[model samples]
Target: MINSITQNALRALLYEVTTEPKPGLVDPGSPGPHSDMNIYTFIDSSLSLTQYFNDAVKIGQTFTGSDLTQMFFALRRKGLAAEKAMLAATHGVNTHKGAIFALGVFTCAESYCHTRHTELFTTIQAMCHGLVEHDLGHICSPQTAGEKEYAEYGYGGARAEAEQGYPIIEEIALPFLKDSTGTIQARLLDTLMKIATRAVDSNLIKRAGNIQVIDWLHEEAAAYLALGGYATDAGKQKLKQLNQECLEHNYSLGGCADLLIVTIFVGLERGYL
Candidate 1:
């Protein structure tokens, strides 16, 4: 079970980076807006986190404590180590930092649910309860990008998403991906845009240096989906244009990308991918 769960987590990371034409993201054909890293960097980073995924599952499978939050803290410590490994692999490039958190929580939650015969999302919610308050509620001086975003815009970023059990993945991306048709690339691209429509995307905001860009991002993604989303020529053109614009503005929808990774993990676990 641990091997399978870790494999799915690795697959999810690889799948998200390989999905093409993703606006402002690193892909095989192009590095998109990022000037620091490329597809190889992401691959190296993904490969480096295998042990972290294994540890997450082991923690979940063996946790017998009543306080699931403690389990979450244990996983977070491993996640910090995973982030260091990812940085080492990428030579200081911050590829997969967000993924290290979101995917770690889901991988841990999935294993816990499998062992206890409980629901996955609710287990995640229980594990992540009070995450936002504990991490963001007492912020006096902003340090990380997430803390800064919370300080300035009240956006909770990944921590808030986990606390809510990843509503975007549960209610949107997974459902959209399950029902999506066409090539795997097309399905994932469409699902990514759908996620972009709803995700706050702190990375995008940070790159644009304004929270208003999220509205523009949402509008563009919604318009792309309205054009039939990667299956139609018009939708493809729109995505290309969106990709160009993101490159021009140097905006990266990394938050949405992390959501897509977690969605893919769950989809794979549920046998939909």
Candidate 2:
């Protein structure tokens, strides 16, 4: 029997790689802000994490008692293994660090939902209670780019998003994705652009060292959306311009890029998109 959690986790990761014209993100059509990482790199990263996803599903499937802490620790073990696999696949490049965290949560949360026969969204949210303050909010030396950004800007990044079960995915990207009209690719492209205009991406801060950059990026995207945003001739030209600007600035809306996958995963699980 196929496990929905594992299937959906892989599907979400694949969706992240396959979606095209994702401005400031890696895609088969374009390499955004990265010379080494491409669609193939992401594919390799996904392949490396396959066993971790399966293990996550198994964690929830095999849980018996009421202690979610055990599941969290078990997930940590799998998460560490998955990180090692991702590093090996990318030759130490961080291709899907954000994807690993986001997808791992969904993978485990879906398994919990399936095993409990409960609704998924709430289950995922419940699984992530007190996530940030416990996991990433504690005092520690800033060792990573994201950690430095978090310490300075207080954006909360992926940890904050996970703490709330990713409200950005639940509220913004998913709605835009579900309600978008046209082909699936077109809809997702629109969703990606729409999402960029709404929130402060931690990756943007990590790259640009300011929260204002995210807002500026949002304004640019909002302007493009007003011009019909990848749905019309003018919008396509504008998108190209935006793509160049992202490359020139050496910044990627990678945080939004990561959440887009989670949004797609949620959409599939909820059966709307």
Candidate 3:
């Protein structure tokens, strides 16, 4: 079985690769089509090694998110950061434009993966791995059969949905603990609280729209923490404390996705997920 640990590791990998656009997947039917072709070629033409991580941190800095939306928000931040980094790295070749594409694809991958759709995830991951070797001369492992199948179908589904003007969050996003009356996953939620608190404290979320979503998630997390008391008083207190602290700091959404990841893993560990 694909346990939560493996799922999380896969999520982390998926998150990293998707932050960059998939090479060779651009719609020929779309716009001016790679007009300049230098950095564009490096991104739209093929994946690059600039997306890889070292010691679990992207290049050097760590990504923060404790919920799925928070995760997307963080990727959004990463995309912006990538643009700046690439600008600095390539002596201002406008490499950051490519970084925006990467972030778009990352959001795309996350939307698909959460919906149990693996197609985009597979293709993106494969391209990213290829980039690792081609651009960086570092060979990573080949993608598995499951990933391949996801790639084959995920694209078509995504395209069709886009044509219909549907939000991917409703159709493909990850499930949250508060989305249902289902049991609470204490350990995971707890970790998520910590991550969320850190993000808010760090001033990661500045946009009003993003802040609204994070605020909602904060309420959801509070509810989850309260529910977790069914398992143990200690769990309840820990969660309560986390929630209180988050409230004190003005609840940032940047870390929500990571918190969600932790919650899911904890639930799975406790047999709640």
Worst 10 residues of 3 by lDDT: 22-31
What digit string (tens of lDDT, one per residue) describes model 1 on residues 204-263? Answer: 999989999999999999999999999999999999999999988888988899999999
In Å, residue 66's CA in model 3 sits off its true spot by 32
Any idea what lDDT model 2 has? 0.79
In TM-score terms, candidate 1 sits at: 0.98
Q: Show where candidate 3 strays beyond 4 Å.
A: 1-182, 185-230, 258-273
Give the per-residue Cα lDDT of candidate 1 at 138: 97
Error of 1 at 106 (Å): 0.5
Give the range where candidate 2 is weakest over 10 consecutive residues by summed lDDT: 118-127
Q: In TM-score terms, which candidate is top?
A: 1
Q: What are the TM-scores, per candidate, against the unseen true structure? A: 0.98, 0.92, 0.25
Clashing pairs in 1: none
- lDDT, model 3: 0.35
Which candidate has the top score in lDDT? 1
Q: Which stretches of candidate 2 lie over 4 Å from their true place?
A: 67-69
Q: What's the lDDT for all of these models?
A: 0.93, 0.79, 0.35
Give the residue spans of candidate 1 off by over 4 A: none
* Model 2 Cα lDDT, one tens digit per residue, 77-119: 8898899999999899888888888878777877887778866
Error of 3 at 242 (Å): 2.0
